[model samples]
Target: MDTLMPADDLTDELRAISAVVATLEHAQQNELPDEFAGLFRHDAIWTTGGGRRLLGRDAISAFTHQVLPGAMAASTATYEVEHVVFIRPDVVAVKVRQTPVGRDGVPLPGVNPGSPTYVMAKEDGRWLLVAAQNTEVVDG
Candidate 1:
């Protein structure tokens, strides 16, 4: 079996991913669909906050351009990856927490801390999100 990557290398990779997340955050904040769409693959599928699924480059772009900006109107959405494990140099799985700010720039309720496992890959030296799914955390 192959051993895990070194801590330093993992840290660097995660940092690169963090930068990609930051870039997406900025594009969403600025309502830049073109820039946002540029971050993902043409055939990528995205799960929306409202429980809808978006597929294909055109659909994904349209969905974001139509819905996300309004849902997050005058708001900001930021995320932090809680954990990242590299399966290979090109593939990583990540657990992330998303926080959305209200129109007043205050954190909103029902933003209920959620977790999503993301599969990311480095394409042409840029980290891109390829696949992801939200994890439900139920407490009894």
Candidate 2:
């Protein structure tokens, strides 16, 4: 178990992590594969909601470029930071909630939200995603 930072420091770290997550959502919404990949570390690893594993920024970029254009053909997605846990002064785990919405901004029916966990690491005073895993919520 890792101890947390001070309140103020934690808040600042959370905010920084949120910014990274915001950029991710923006890139996805706009279908900008390069912009999306730019948020990750060079050796970052990502597991898609559909369980595809992407190793490194280049692999992630390739996968995004191939799938993102058609991904939002019928809907858009909004991502929100749900929680943040600092495992170390320079590392944090962020949980995000992702909802898919129609063009009218209303959530689409029968589509459960996505839960994504992003592990971020601070490098050269900037936070970059080191690893991420996205999972779809399924009702049993």
Candidate 3:
């Protein structure tokens, strides 16, 4: 068995991964389905916070385009990168915190937060989302 050691470019890799999450937040807030869809790999799988499972980039793109328009009329979301674990030199698992916010940036009322985990791979010097699962945190 071998231990997972931190690579010398860990900081740079984290920045790159975090940029992806930032782009996600921006795309969602602006209702840009195409931009959001571009983040994923062609064969990626995604399970939404509402428990909808999407397979492949085309499916994800269709779903996003279908539901993303005007979805932010009342509120949008902010995504923050919480953790990044390097699965290998070219792969990573990223944890993100999602909060629904109003136009003024305040947290929206009666809206639960979301926790999303993104698995990404470095392809051609760019990080692409491979698989992602978004879960909503409900208060008990």
Candidate 4:
């Protein structure tokens, strides 16, 4: 097994994770990615809001292209990074909230002002999300 890397090496990974989150938030709230090269691991997996399961980058990217624009068309996404923990030097877990907007600029249906848990891993100095699942907390 690979020895755990140092904490300092985690910065780049963290930055990459942040970039992915930012890009995803951007993609979710207003637009979609024309391609899915840098944002996700080639083998990434995601669980949709409606509980549909999608595996692999191509499937996820295709799902994004088909779904996001109509479901989340408003350009108003707010994000909050709740926690970042180092499970190992190459692995980190993040909790965050990505707010979405309605067509009238109001918060959208099924999108509460809350958070979700995301798991990201550093691979060859690049952080890519391996898994992302939702939090059960309701917007208060």
| Winning model by lDDT | 3
Question: What local distance difference test score does each model get?
Answer: 0.72, 0.88, 0.91, 0.68
Most TM-score-accurate candidate: 3
- Tens digits of per-residue lDDT, candidate 1, 1-140, equal 24277778767777899887777777877778877877777777778655677777678788778755555566676677787777888887777776667656577666565566677888888788787565443330
| Residue ranges of candidate 4 with Cα displaced over 4 Å | 1-13, 35-37, 102-111
lDDT per residue for candidate 2 within 9-108, as digits (tens), equals 7778778889998899889888888899899999999999989999999999899899988677678888999887778889888889999888667988
Which is better, 2 or 4, measured by lDDT? 2
Would you give me the overall lDDT of model 2?
0.88
lDDT assessment of candidate 4? 0.68
TM-score of each: 0.79, 0.92, 0.93, 0.74
Arrange candidates, best TM-score first: 3, 2, 1, 4
Q: Candidate 2: which stretches are off by over 4 Å?
A: 1-4
Ordered list by lDDT, greatest first: 3, 2, 1, 4
Which 10-residue span in candidate 2 carries the lowest summed lDDT? Answer: 1-10
Q: Note each model's CA RMSD in angstroms.
A: 3.0, 1.9, 2.3, 4.2
Worst 10 residues of 3 by lDDT: 1-10
Q: List pairs with backbone clashes in candidate 4.
A: none
lDDT of 3 at 45: 99
In angstroms, the error of model 2 at 92 is 0.7
